[model samples]
Target: MEYIDLYLIHWPMTVKPGKYEFPFPKDEIEPFDMKSVWEAMEECLRLGLTKAIGVSNFSSKKLHALLSTAQIPPSVNQVEVNPLWQQRKLRELCVAKGIQICAWSPLGARGALWGSDGVMECAVLMEIAEAKGKTLAQICLRWVYEQGDVVLVKSFNEKRMMENLDILGWELSDEDNHKISQIPQCKGYQGLDFVSPSGLTNPSWSFGMVRFDSIIVERERLQRTVGLIEPIVDSAVIPSGIVISSIYLKYKKMGRIPEVLLISAAPDSKPMPMIGFGTATYPFGPSEAARSAVVRAVAAGYRHFDTAAVYGSETSLGEAVADAVESGLVGSRDELFITSKLWCSDAHSDRVIPALRKTLQNLQMEYIDLYLIHWPIIRNFALDREIPPAVNQVEVNPLWQQKKLREFCVEKGIKICAYSPLGAKGTVWGNDRVMECEVLKEIAQAKGKTLAQICLRWVHEQGDCVLVKSYNDQRMKENLEIFDWELSEEDKYKINQIPQQRSVPAEDFISDVGPFKSLMELWDGEI
Candidate 1:
């Protein structure tokens, strides 16, 4: 071949140059020099021998070591992933680093000499397959697919290959995922076939072996000496996003669930919850904060999450979903709605798909429920493209009703989504007008509602989906209480009379040399 698309170091350790065989002599087994080997892989990419370079069977600890010194990081990490042996910790690291996970033994290598039928014989998987009218293998593949990992199944039979491909277009329910999570986890391959006794005991000899079972006790004893729990089994079973406290659950029970918007134009469109948790934090908080906040939101019964590439919260959102699924906070990521945007930097038609793929990677999800153009302008392309715009997300509140934009979207069969319903007070792009308005305060006081709730309920009453951001736990639950209430005619009249002024006027893009010269052009005079 002229060039290979992907080249990966199959295993971390280097054997003697003579013959390719397993269980080599102890002397022939040498420590895998990660830095030098990754550098060589980088050279392969530079010379066009391979389009991308990556690693296989790398542990989280080993990956951190390699990532520390490598000039070019691995693009993918091929590992063993099945419901029976879910590699949650390693997958978490891979997701965070933007490394694609290529599953090697998705079905536990069912028919191979070295493989087991554990995944195929999994009772939970068998039950799920039967209920879904699918084969056990299909259930396994679909589960891996749901995790947003690339499946590398080794199937030969034409009929079975067709069955494998049929795994798409259906999903495993939350109960199925929860049952699968409770299954006993055991590593199929313990690296015993490759490692010698000396390598097992010697600290420096087996840095390349990524399996947790073979090195956990020694590594933990040598590293920090914490014995609170079986680290591997504990982390593997409980998802990374699982909530330890009952605070979220308590708040969730207290809040009313938001109504959902059915977007018929979307592919396999799930109902987009009218009220969503906004992930863009002013002052740009840490990813941990985002992750924790999302978990809390999920616990508080918030289903829709609005994020963007520019927001830098996609990774945390993805992590939180994974944690929630694993922890049974939710049945699946499918239960929630995720909406992201096409940033202006990638607004062009050619870059749109790539930008979306990057967003999926950042979110650690296979598909986004709704994807929208973040801003009005595209670098070199018109806003009118082949893909029908399904939703128009804009700032909508008592202060800025956006009636013109809402009317236009209705005419075009597009859903109208409101953001900053409380005027995004305290943010640089927002104003205090909506929250501080006497008209809104009066309505809220009369109705025994919070000022923020009055604004959200008004937007909801207008039949617009609203996005509200609050990392605080109490406020997070309070945002969902709007669906149970309604605005009276007096309240509606007062809100309608409130002075209208757009809070976030795309001022950054309104420059002399840019596509938009004024707020009117930026918003097409809808402002």
Candidate 2:
């Protein structure tokens, strides 16, 4: 007990309470509730469970989210920080928040999971190490120490251990630091399997992929753009980038339901609602049904609409917007954000603008707020003039996490508006892999939220705009209700641990008779 000075949650995602397994099986993980869990940590502080409570592998955004509700913010964040994987964002955020930065994989985890060979093999680190008359590992540890970070280094050999402890004796030159910073960042260790959804039920196969800062990066994106959020009635969610706030203002208006949170693309772009209404449905569902749902969505305070030419519901969606304007549900078409996509057949370079124009014509709108290549794979590609797509529509959920694709989109500054976030559990081609997942069900039961709500909220929590579709008016309203509440850090964690599957795979097109060959050829083996 005396030796244990600090206790930490090693990873954010919590596996089932019993025992930990490498290829963690299905129904073995529980959703993580960050605030509630932190509160428990605070209780530990009261009981002297440990002198300090800390977290490992947390990013800036995750730390910020933790800080948002923590009674006692984390004392430290121990993470991988090396010459090869510099974690600059996490470092700066920790400094600003007065939480000490602790580097765990100081030498890039050469023999461990999530470690990259790049750190040991880096030309820049080798150059510095040779010049300084130190081991490359020593130089790596020294570099982290030079950055005012506490480095946790390990060595099993006596001589190597002495050298590991000797990092403080020497310094890395300023020129060397610059070169190290410019090493052309690529992740070394990827443990995305920790949060992947598909491996749970089927234990033999696992989702082995890279997870950079989904918890941190996505949260940082939201915080930088949307700012801090509070659930109290006094607080408003990202409205006009902070115009006014007063707890007493509720008296000025009574019984007012919260509206969709509005965020700007840039400082100049008009504010657009985050939760959008999806016009896509079961292939057999009628356009009129989608049209009616759009009306209900708008009346329920959704101002963003998503559709595609492939979905064949654009005209009805447009008519619904027109009807909403005429009936005073919305002041003008400008108040709503409309997004459409180019189906595969018309996804050709020359056909791109024409397809968008066709969609615009069908919707009776002059310009679309967003347009996307409905599918990223280009069976054929060249170039033609067209507006840049503001978003890319994809099927994202706990089961189909799409970690690599999501990270790439986040890196490229493209918004990922997820459709079918619940995995379309009841659809003909769809299965219960999503809604019936025990982790999701546990989260729903714990939070007192529906399975659909937990899934929708999971998508939103990942810091992407989400589109939800429902035929019934009540369900439409229910789908639109995601904005007012939130999922906890634990909820997000459990969702992350769900095994990944390729939802809505174009198997028909991926067969030997079709384009290229194999689903692996199509997805680059991400599935």
Top model number, lDDT: 1
How far does residue 286 in candidate 2 sit from its true spot (Å)? 5.4
* Candidate 2 residue runs with Cα over 4 Å from true position: 1-272, 284-286, 378-389, 511-515
Q: Tens digit of lDDT per residue, candidate 1, span 122-234?
A: 66688788998889989999999999999987677899988888877988887787666545355555453444322343454344332232221222111111111111112
Candidate 2, residue 154: Cα displacement in angstroms equals: 48
TM-score of each: 0.51, 0.48
lDDT of each: 0.71, 0.64
What is the overall TM-score of model 2 with all chains considered together? 0.48
lDDT of predicted model 1: 0.71
Over 368-426, each residue of candidate 2 has an lDDT whose tens digit, in order, gives: 77666665542111112133344556778889876776666554444566777887777
Query: Number of the top candidate by TM-score?
Result: 1
Model 1 ranges off by over 4 Å: 1-258, 261-264, 377-387
